[model samples]
Target: MRFVAKRQKEGVNVSDTHPLVEASTLIVGLAAIFAIIAVALIFVVELALYFVSAEDEANLFGDWLPDDLITVAPNDERLYQTQLLVDRLASHWPGAPYTFRVEIDDSEIANAMALPGGLIIVTQGLLNQVESENELAFVLGHELGHFRNRDHIRALGRGIVLSMFFAVVTGNDAAGIGIKAADITLRGFSRRQETRADEFGLGLVHSEYGHVDESWRLFERWNIDGSSFLDLVTYLSTHPETGDRIADMKRHAELERWPVDGEITDLSW
Candidate 1:
């Protein structure tokens, strides 16, 4: 009986030590589980952002500019001509629907924009500054490239996703979080998307009219004669850098062997 008790006491001691080992193991296991959950949550948030951004882009543009605002000036032959150019370029994308609207804003902001649902807006300032139809086509093609790749939607998605991530991580309001996300998203587009748009825009210009130099010339004109600082604040707010973008356009043109000389059509809007 005494021998059995002595062995039993030894067993109890070993069992006590076993728990220390098991406790350490349990802590490590739990930590790994938490880490996995964190990673999974991050992925889920990113995926959710992608879809949310696309939807938000559609909604935001839809709400801001109703179809009623898309008016064309009478005798605006240039506006019609711009639309025709945009249509011809967009046709290359195969079943891509686009609408061109010329917003005659005398804001001195030389800019054109493509919104979702085939909406294109060109400031009168932009029309006035462009030297030729080819340069205008280049700008329009770049905007259309954005639409073709659904870049705005992707940008919105990235913003929403990032906002959700920060909100969840920091426990902030979704609205505030979303604003921060948008700020980040607009700071700079993905390098890949920017390159793709540049290439696509160059291809369109080269294919349609063979006026690749127009792209570079347009950028030079904007740099030299674009709106003043206060005027450009709004323009640069959306379009960050002018010089670098121009450089990129030039590089892409050279790489693609686009023609250096082509007549700039005298179509002033």
Candidate 2:
């Protein structure tokens, strides 16, 4: 008994590692290692997006989506007109491997998004905000640029890896992480992606309509008056500034000899 006490006091004969402690340490180590890996994956995907074109990437995610999430645009006159506009404008963009599919979202968010494999969603609030078909066409053209360059897939992968990092830190409960990533992914594109989309859309609109100035008018029409602090999210967080974007559009139109002012396309608004 005395010998045991002595040994215990010395701690030389005792096991230094407790089972609970070892387990917790292992979990922490794994979380850290995996977090690094996940971060690396995000960077890898960002780089990979440069080489991969739209035709090469295919996503069947729509099949897994429930009917409630996606509503096929009804045969309403507005939808018919929107579809006609999309089809006519899309014709000007070449080498599109997947046939474009447009659907209406029931949400009130004044926004749009592109998914992998030629999927596009336009929200109810977005439709309500557009003053004319030309404005809507600009919005559509931007989303199409996302599809054409496969920005959607790159963004999705980036979001997933980031969410994984969140899950690891949250002990695998990353619902908040998922929500944040979704908000970021859906609301705005990366600076490079956004610039590319703008270039694509502005060029397409110019090519199709002959006037590019009013394309920036959509920016003006999106009123943030009486908006809460949260309303500045897209403006503050990841997106390029709206003023800068309008200026860029003007400069680009000037460079391309694209019309900033000319006979504006007549839309039956």
Candidate 3:
């Protein structure tokens, strides 16, 4: 005898979960995985940085810098004075791997950047903003702190990891987006690094001058209310707000009982 055909149950072919729900779950899982791998890679990079000597860093990155910058003349009084400060601070850093040098870039941007090796690029605008040696020491110490912690290499390694991950996932089509994404992701890390550097710099300032003195004033001078468009943008930037950093340093000094007041040293150059 022939068997009768039977009707399929309603919704038997469909999954119990909604399509959107499945999609959302998959997306969240993937994101969690990606985050884990990225964090692991970052941790690996940080660990590797410990093994890479500072001399190795200088050798690797020294030539990447431009040699043609209109660096202040070695004989220039201002340059000489700045170098003197560097030498003094560096003396406190016994067994320092690199001999630090400050190069004054003839730019109006009020910024100081730590380059690979011991080179520090200080903008003329930053110098113009300086009111005293203590202020300048704070800036220099901040850069030195970057070097002490090997932040440049840490950042570079983290960027490479993000870029590579994105390039592989996106078939190299979304590398720019990947970089921007990395920058945004790394902003918090960068801010912490900046804060730590501030502390390191503050210590150097105190050690060299016997008082923390005017170090925090550099940030105080740059303090801006978040009302302006540009000022608001700073919230998203890598460095912490200048005012917040100043407050942090003051709090730090108070905790350490480091003297914040002393005779202000004038910058003759």
Candidate 4:
């Protein structure tokens, strides 16, 4: 009994498994648990969002625009013309839940992003890159597509999931072990979502215009062939390869029998 007590005091026998193997198994298990919790939470968030009215979404995120962004005045010529284009596009989707608003960010970043409640922000750099009204329309349509599909809300839910995951796992050194793997998975998901948005945008462009001309011109600048850093890390990117995206758009247009050529409208601004 004394020997048994001494052994008990010494703690349970060392695991037969190698220490490294045991640690790895423990880390993998914890990571799996975190992943499961995150997925469940995200599912709950999505279900909750379904019951939340569009008006409620607008009310919740109406003033959520970044404070650091300097938006062009509503009366600015560029802003005015862009708003008109958005209005024209919105007309095509009369069933959309929220009233669309356009804001031009006074920055050089060549990008556009959709926000909750039908807010679309385009950087000045994107405006600089745009060569025609049809190209610009495609961009706007893509953002509108995000709104139509509620991608922005899903993105918000994903962010919340990540935050909750990190909150629960942060203290342990192993917390960071799963981040890169998770990021790669999320990026793949994002790339697919972007492709869907692109497809939707192409359809909208075809619907609005008699043909789908110049809809893919916005991606032309990046349609180079080379094995650069970007190529090496394509899998890690949230966006798909620009050249492939353009090719896919062309193929889709072909399948739909949409004319790829038409009169391109110059941007008024």
Q: Give the alpha-carbon lDDT of every model.
A: 0.64, 0.68, 0.77, 0.77
| Tens digits of per-residue lDDT for model 4, 1-269 | 35443434443566567889988887888667655665566578779778987788877777677678798776789888988898888788867787788889887756788888788998887787788999999989888888887888877777776766677668865677665445444555567778788888888888888899989875765464332344324322545777788888899889889999998888897
Candidate 4 residue pairs that clash = none
- Model 2 misplacement above 4 A: 1-39, 46-53, 56-73, 171-189, 223-238, 263-269
Which lDDT tens digits does candidate 1 get at residues 176-200?
Answer: 4344444444344455566677678
Error of 3 at 176 (Å): 8.2
lDDT by residue (184-241, candidate 3, tens digit) is: 5666577889889989888899999989998977566456433333433442264677
For candidate 1, which ten residues in a row score worst on lDDT?
Answer: 174-183
- Which of the predicted structures, 3 or 4, would earn the higher TM-score when compared with the native? 4
Clashes of each: 2, 0, 0, 0
Best by TM-score: 4
Give every collision pair in model 3.
none
- Candidate 1: list runs displaced more than 4 Å: 1-64, 67-75, 97-106, 155-182, 190-192
